[model samples]
Structure formats: structure tokens, C-alpha cells
Target: MRAALPGARTRPSARARRERTAGLAFISPWIFGFLVFTAWPILYSGYLSLTDYDVLTDPSFVGLDNYERMVGDPQVRLALWNTLQYTLLQVPLYVLVALALALLLHQAGRASGFFRTAFFVPKMTPPVAVGVLLLLLFNGEYGLVNEALGAVGIDGPSWTTDPDWIRPGLALVSLWSVGAAVVILLAALQDVPVELYDAARVDGAGWWRRTRTVTIPMISGALFFVTVVNTIAAFQMFTEAYSAYFGAGNSTYSNDAALFYVIYLFREGFAELHMGYASALAWLLFVVIMLVTAVQLLVSRRLVYYEGEQR
Candidate 1:
């Protein structure tokens, strides 16, 4: 190694500078888009949350008034409760369905690819279409669901008309698009070491015991990811519920059971033109999601297993 002068500083060669410039040029579009479309909008919404703005007039500063109003709003409580119920009902069922599908496909050998694709096809369907499909399948009288129940000598509840069945019906409908989680979990399952299963088998572990002791722990990270993502999605549920119960032609159906947080936020912002209050609602949701995610992270430290992580 050659000794360098004490005061000398190294400079990038021409090639290095050119490569850096090229890299920056390649990412500039994404940087610009993030600033304009994502970052700016989030900052602006935060500012709007503290103001009183209806689209027609300029935003008037309101400090904590909007948030205070939320504290007293019965509809806010109702919406939050509905969302919580939906999250609790849907997330576990969704994970179980996705995991079941993933496990079945994992054993499918050469046919796994075909089955995986088939399962994922529904996930590509538009939310609006899914909402319409929900109405059709769960219609009070002539729907396919009730028809199938009738075949088994069971009576199906009026899913659309009855408020009591609405949340459960929506939760059931949400399972139709668990493909992404299935794919994630399937990938995680594939990554688990064959040696682990082999060891369990050698110890006379049965299928269920081996799965409980080996398979689940190996994929806990993926399970954690799916749970967090699904929870957030549940909280933000809007388009499907809106289209099913609140859309122009669907207004005849009962909406109280399906009045999710984001649907209420959408109604306040777009329908009633209470943009400021909607922004506050959005912020509150953001804070809640952040807190919930933080708690999940804390819990995951104990529950989630990572390969090569320090014990």
C-alpha cells in the first residue's frame, strides 16, 4: 500500500461520477413522483386536518376542533366499532383460508403452479366488481349462497337486508381475495428446510404435530406480515362496503352493519364535503394503525421466529 499525503482527499474518478449521475437520472422520476403524489399529499392532509375546509371556501384554521368533534360523534364510534368487528372477524378467517390453500398447494407437486394461478385469479378482480358480486351472491331470496344452504336443508340469513348478518357476510366475501396472502405464505412454506420436517418425522411426529412444531414456527414471519397487512386493509375497507350498501342503486339495503371507518371518512369528505373533518379522521386512522403496528412489532419480538436471529 502506498502512503497518502496528510492533507490530501480522494475524489471520485470520472467513471464513478458518471455512474452516480446515471443512477440518479434513473431514480429521478420516482423521486419526483413520490414528492408530488405521495409525500406532498400526506403533508397537506395533515395540515388540512387542523383546518375547517369545505371545498367551496378556503381552509379556516380550527386547531383541535375537528378532532374534538370526532370524540363526541356517535357515527365515529359506530364506524370504528364496525371496523373493529370486521377486522376481528375477517383477519383470522382470511389467514386460515390462505394458509389452508397454501398448504394444499405445497403438497401439489407439479400441479402446484396451476392451482396457485387458479387461486390467485380472483384477487385480480376489481373491488367494485367484487361488491356487485357480493350483492348477487348474498341476495335475500334467490342468491346462490341461500340456494346452496337450501340444498343442505339449512336456512340462510338475509345477508344483504339483515343488519345482523352484514358484517359476517362482508367478512366471508373478503375471503374471496386471499390470493396474495396465500402466495406469501406458500413462498414461506417453500423456504422452510426439508431437514426440519425429516427430523420431526424421525422422532415419530405425526402430521399435525410436525406442522405445529415445525411448519408454523418457520413461517411465523410471513404470518405476521399477512396479519399486519390484512389488519390495515380491514381498517381502510371502503369501496366494497360502499358499493354494496351505499351506491346509487344499492341504497335500499341496510348500511349500519357495513358502515366501516373509511366508508364514513369517504362520506364525510366527498358526500358531505367536510374535507377538514375527513382529514382528521384520516389522521386518527393513521395514528391508530401506527400504534397497532407498533404493538404487533413488540409482540412479534417474542412470537415471530427469524432465521439466524439472535436468541
Candidate 2:
């Protein structure tokens, strides 16, 4: 080989430097925004979680006092239990209902497109508006839901006022937004190979058998995605609770049944001004969500069948 040029290494390195500089230049805005908005806030919140920080006073370092308080705090326990209960109630039911709706609508033929739009209208509605509509529909006495029950000679539960009905009422509201998941599942259903169904039918698979094998396994990815997202949303439930009970100064009327984790965190951070404790609560919520998501992913690894991945 000939002797290496003196400038060869320098030229390649210089080109790399230029390319790196260009990449950095392109991403600098996002970097700056993330640092200023997301990363810095997260870091500062972690710091705050270890302190006794009221908005009005300087933060005093208190180690894990905030976290320790969470153990003895009845409200914290109530909020956590209530959140878990809501998650248990909402996520599975929502998934099942959405999947059923998708299945039904997907087979509607000429009416499928129109019905899809109608169903998706609920998802497109603002959360606040949905909350308002829910309040009206489920109002204890004069609400249309109660009125319908009365007409059927069945007394409806006091949805907004009674503790026993609070979570279930909220679950109903949550289910109304299942249109989003329905849309996703519907798209997944559309993408499923028709030949697979034909082959399954030729193999003497009944409708239920075909659905169990061909429909569900094939759409399992979308199901997994929607389930994980809904679980996270269930954990962070606040707007529905706030709208149902706390809005219009009705907090006093409603009991702890509706005091979801994020709702309580909001109360602590903003209402009580326990910034440090609130930060701790926020971090705990973050960890819980991450852990739950990790568990879901792990389980889905065994259950969820990707279209092309080897079993």
C-alpha cells in the first residue's frame, strides 16, 4: 500500500464534525424545549419531592418525609384504592365493549362507514363536554337515565351523589370514549387477511371459532396498544371525577369514592399547597404507571401475536 495521505484522516474527521454539527443544529430547538419544559421540570420535581415545599415558603429538605406521609395518609390510601378500582372496572370493560363495537361495525357493510363516523363522534368530543353530558344523563332524580329506569319500573341508583355508584358512574362515562379504541380495532380488523378467514371457514371453523382464532389473534397488537393506553388513562383519571363531584362546588356532597390519585394530587399541590408532597405523589404515580406498563409489555410478549414475528 502507498503511504497514507496526511490529510485523509483529517478530511474524514472534519466531514463527520460537520455532519454532527448539522444534526445538532436540526435538533437544537427540541433539545432546548425539552430541557426548559420537560427535563428541567422533572428534575426539579424530583428535588422538590424530598423537601417540605409549600408554594409560599422556601423548600426545606425533609428526606422521605413526603413519601413516608403517604403510608399513614388515609386520603392517599383512599385515592390509590379508588384509582385501582376504577382501572379494574374501566379498562377491561372498555376494551371488551370497544372490541365488540368494532366487530359489529366492521360487518355492517354499506352502513359501516356512516356508523363508524357516528361512533367516533364521541371520541372527538371534548372531555369537558363529555363530562357535562354525563352529568346530565346520570343525574340522580330527573336525569334521562333515571327516567328511563323509572319507566321500566326499576329505580336507578343515585349516580352522582351515592358513594356506591360513583366509580360505576365514572366507568360509564369512560366507556363513552371507547370510540377511539373501536376505531383502532376496526382498522386492524380491516387489515386482517380475508384469505385467512376463508381458509379457516374451509377448515370448518364456525363464526365464533373463526373470530376466536382469526379475528382476536390477528388484532391482538391493537388490543394490547389500546389496553395499555386505557390503563394509563384510568390511573390518571381526574377530569371525570372533578366534573362529576368537585365541579360547581359539589365536593362537599361527594365522599372519598371519587377521590382518584391524580385528583388528590391536584388537591394537595394546588389546593393545599403541599408542593413537595404533591411532587412525591406525582413521582409515585409515574413509577406506578411505568411498572404497570412494563408488566403489560412482559405479559403481552407471551400473549400478543405480531403478524410476521415467529412464535
Candidate 3:
């Protein structure tokens, strides 16, 4: 080949440069926010996890001490077990209730919009407000839930007070927020081709058969989306539990049963001023969530159906 020309550099035109600058300028806020608020904090926390930092003092290096202590911390184990129980109870029930509600709303025809909005109203309610409402309804005496149960000659359990019933109470609280999942599933249901259901019916499939064979497979992507989202939310459960049992840092009436993992982390970090230890807890939780999500994705490979994929 001939030798290259000395002045053969090709730079972007002024218009192209201007367009690129404008695009970068438009996204600069998001970039800055992510770097400052999300990425930096994550990295800082990871560093802090290896130190013995109280907020009042500088972080002094303490390699693996926090991680070692975590293994023997009874409170951490309690919190983990409680959180696991809550997740186990909440996720499946939430999905089932959401799917059922979506199915009912889908069949409502003229009343569909009204019913959907009504169901979603509970989700729009603030978590604090929901906590208050739950306390009022589940109070030991003169609560509406007990009153209804009494009317049927069945005494309702003391939901908020009894440790045995605390997880169930929290489960009920979670069920109230299933409206968002229902709305998502409803949207997915609408997108599914009616012709598929019609074809299933023509092939002598009944309602259950149609749902299992057509509706489920068609909406599996949205189902998987909701499952993954709710799984993450369940793992990071804090606000509702805090508002319900330990608002304003008051741990009164909060039993070990209700001590969720994040609540324990909050107590250690802010209340006890063990910021470094709390950072370690946060990182551990992050790892748990990642592992759980990975397992789910692996399982979903066998279950979740994407459109246009070969059999």
C-alpha cells in the first residue's frame, strides 16, 4: 500500500459535534445524579464495610471483623429468618391475588375501568397510612376485623399484638398493595391475543384449560417481571414494617418476630451508631438479593415463555 497522507485526519463535522454535545448535555443531569447518589454511595459503603466507622468519627480500618461478627449475631439471624418468612408468605400470595384480580377485572367489560381504579386505590395509599389502618382494624379490642369475626361467632386473633400472628398481619399488609401487580398483569392480559383463547376453546378447552394453556404462557414475560420486582421489594422491606411497629425509632411493641433484616440494619446503623457494621449488613443483603435473583433467572429459563422463541 502507498504511504498515508500526513494531513488525512477526518474529524466530525461541526453539526455532528453540536448534536453529540446537545445529547450529552440532555443526559448530563441523569449521569451526574447516578454518579453522585447511586454509584459513589455504593462504592463508599463497600469501603465502609471494611472499617469501624461511627458517624461521629472517621472510618478506621477493621478488616473482616464486621463480617465475622455477623455470623454470630443473634439479632441478624432473627432478622434474616423473619424477613425470609415474610418473603415466603408474601410473594406467592401477592402473585396469586394479583393474577386473580386481573382476571376478574379483565372479564368486567363495562365495569372494567371502574374496578381497576378501585383496586389500585389501595396501592396509592401511603405506607404510613396503611400501617395506621392495619393497626386500627387489627387492634385486640373493638377492631372492625374482630367485630366482623365476632358477628360470625368466630373470634379473630390479636393480629398486631401476638407474635404468632405478626407475620400473618404483615402478609395482609402486603396483600393490600397487590393492586400495582394486578394493574401490570391486567395490561399484559390485554395484550394477549384473544384469538389464542378462542382457538383453545374451539379445541374443546374449558376455562381452566384455556388459562393454563393460553393465558399463562402468553403472559409469562409479565408474570416473570412482576415476580422479580416483588422479590426485590420483599428483600428490601423496610417502610411498611417500620411504620407498623417501630416508627420514629421507637421499638415499643416490636417483637423479634417483626424485626425485619433492613430494620435491624437501620437499628445498628443509626440507633446504635454502628455504621460500619450496618454497611456490612447492607452489602450482605445486596449479595443475598443478587443470588436469589440469579436463582430465579436460572429457574425462569425453564418456565418463562417469550414470544417468537422457537420451541
Candidate 4:
């Protein structure tokens, strides 16, 4: 049976080798783009974080000055708090809503394509439009939201006003464009083997158990991916806040209610021309995101079960 043919297993056919080469060659462009655009800036920013680089002047060595200021700067602390608040409040809301939507579409067993497209429509909308729409919806004076509240015998607060309600406004704005997340979770749900659900049912497991024992484990990777990605987005929240309240360069619109870490970094970096401080802000964000992700990974290992891993 061995070596029956002279050239058996001698070489991959020309087309097969070409296909492999072509695949690698095709992806090389993306690899180049990532290194040039992403890797360079990250490395550059880290270097700048250690120096005072005002665009007007050559970068002056500042050795830990930016980091020290970041620790003491009141606005830095405030921005960090705001970013964390966004992560805690919005990530859960977005991920849970996405999961719920994914599960609903998954269980519908019909019209899934329709529901998926419907849910994904929001992500396609321009962020500017979303900000304007939310502004109109949550506006206090003669806005649709206040009008609705008035009809229900309640008055809505001035959304862009009222420090206490500002975060809520941000969170509300966060929910509008979660279509990307929904699409992701939907894909994950699609891969959940239906046989597991049937087996759980046959074993007298209730809905909760089905989710815990079947759905969650199977989709845990997607969950982690969405969580980390959403957390990073939340930490970098700027568009909603900037467009709605603090446009181009009028400073922060309100009592810095919408002051996010990235927004602050932008102001400190470009507007105020504190390049070193802004770089410090960026690096602090990197550290915080890393720490938060590490913590989540640690905790998730306890709860995020992967399929076939013994409980």
C-alpha cells in the first residue's frame, strides 16, 4: 500500500500552492496597514507619554512628569470616573440587550434574517444623526421626550443641563447604536447547538438552567469579546458627548457632565496643547483598560464556562 505512486504526496498541486500563497499575500496588505497605522501610533504615543511634545516645539524630555500630573489632575480623575461609569452602566445594558435580542432571534426559529437586519439598522446610521435624534428626544424644552413625560404627569429634566441626569443622558445615548453588538451576539447564538437545548429539556432543566448550562458556555467567547470591545468603546466615548454638547472647541458644554476620558485627552492634547498631559491620559487609559480586562478575564474564568470543560 505504501508508495504505490511515484509522485504521491510529493507536492501540493500548483493551484493549491497558489491559493495558499494568494491567501497570505492578500492578508499582507492588512498586516502592513495595521503596523503602519495602528502599531506606530501606539508605540509613538507611549514614547510621547514620557515627553513634553508641544507641536510648536521639539519634544522636551519630561520623565514621569505627565504620569505624576495624571495622578493629581482633578480633571483626569473625573474623566476616569466618567469613563468607568460609562463602562459599568452601558456595557451591561448593551451586552444584555444584545444577548436578549440574539436569544429572541435565535429562538424565533423563523424570520431570523428579518429580525437580524432590523436590529442591525441602527449601527448603519451616522453617529451625527443619532446624536441629533437623541438630542431631540431627550431635550427638556418642547422636546418629544418632555412632551411624553408631560403627558404622563412627569417633567423631564433639562438633558444637557442637570448634572445628576447627565450620565443618564449619556447612557440613553449609548443604547441607540448597539446594532454591531447585536449582530455579534446573534452570530454567537446561531452557533449554539440546538441539541444541547433539547438535551437540557429532556433532563427537566428549566429555562434558567438551559441558559446557564447550555447557552452561556457556548457563547462565552463572544461575550468576552463584546465585553472588552464595548468597554474600550465606552472608555473612548467622545462622539456622543462631543457632538451633543461640546462641539468642535467651545470647551465642555455643561459642568463637564459629558467629560469622558478621550474627550478630555483631546482637549488636553490639541485644544489646550498639553501634549504630554494628553499622552499621559492616553497611557493611563491603556493601563486602566488592561487592568479591567485582566480582572474580568480572571473573574470570567470562574463563571464563563466553555463547552466540554468540567464544572
Error of 3 at 70 (Å): 0.4
Tell me the tens digit of each residue's lDDT in model 3 across 179-201.
89989999999999989988988
Better of 1 and 4 by TM-score: 1
Task: Report how far residue 265 has shifted in candidate 4, in Å.
Answer: 0.5
Tell me each candidate's TM-score: 0.93, 0.90, 0.91, 0.85
- lDDT (Cα, 0-100) at 146 in candidate 1: 96
**Models sorted by TM-score, best on top:** 1, 3, 2, 4
Misplaced by over 4 Å in model 2 are: 1-27
For model 4, the superposed segments whose C-alpha errors exceed 4 Å read 1-26, 248-253, 308-311
Clash count, predicted structure 2: 0
Say which prediction, candidate 1 or candidate 3, comes out ahead on TM-score: 1
In candidate 4, the residue pairs with backbone N, CA or C atoms under 3 Å apart (3 or more residues apart, or in different chains) clash, namely: none
Per-residue lDDT of model 4, residues 1-311, tens digit only: 45648656666889999999999999999989999999999998888889988889989888998988877789987887877776788888888988888888887777988878887887878777776776778877877878988999997898767766777777877777777888898888888888999999999999999998889888988998898888888888887777777765435347477788898999999999988778888888888888988988898887675767788
lDDT of each: 0.94, 0.91, 0.90, 0.82
Error of 1 at 1 (Å): 4.6
In model 2, what is the error at residue 218, expressed in angstroms? 0.4
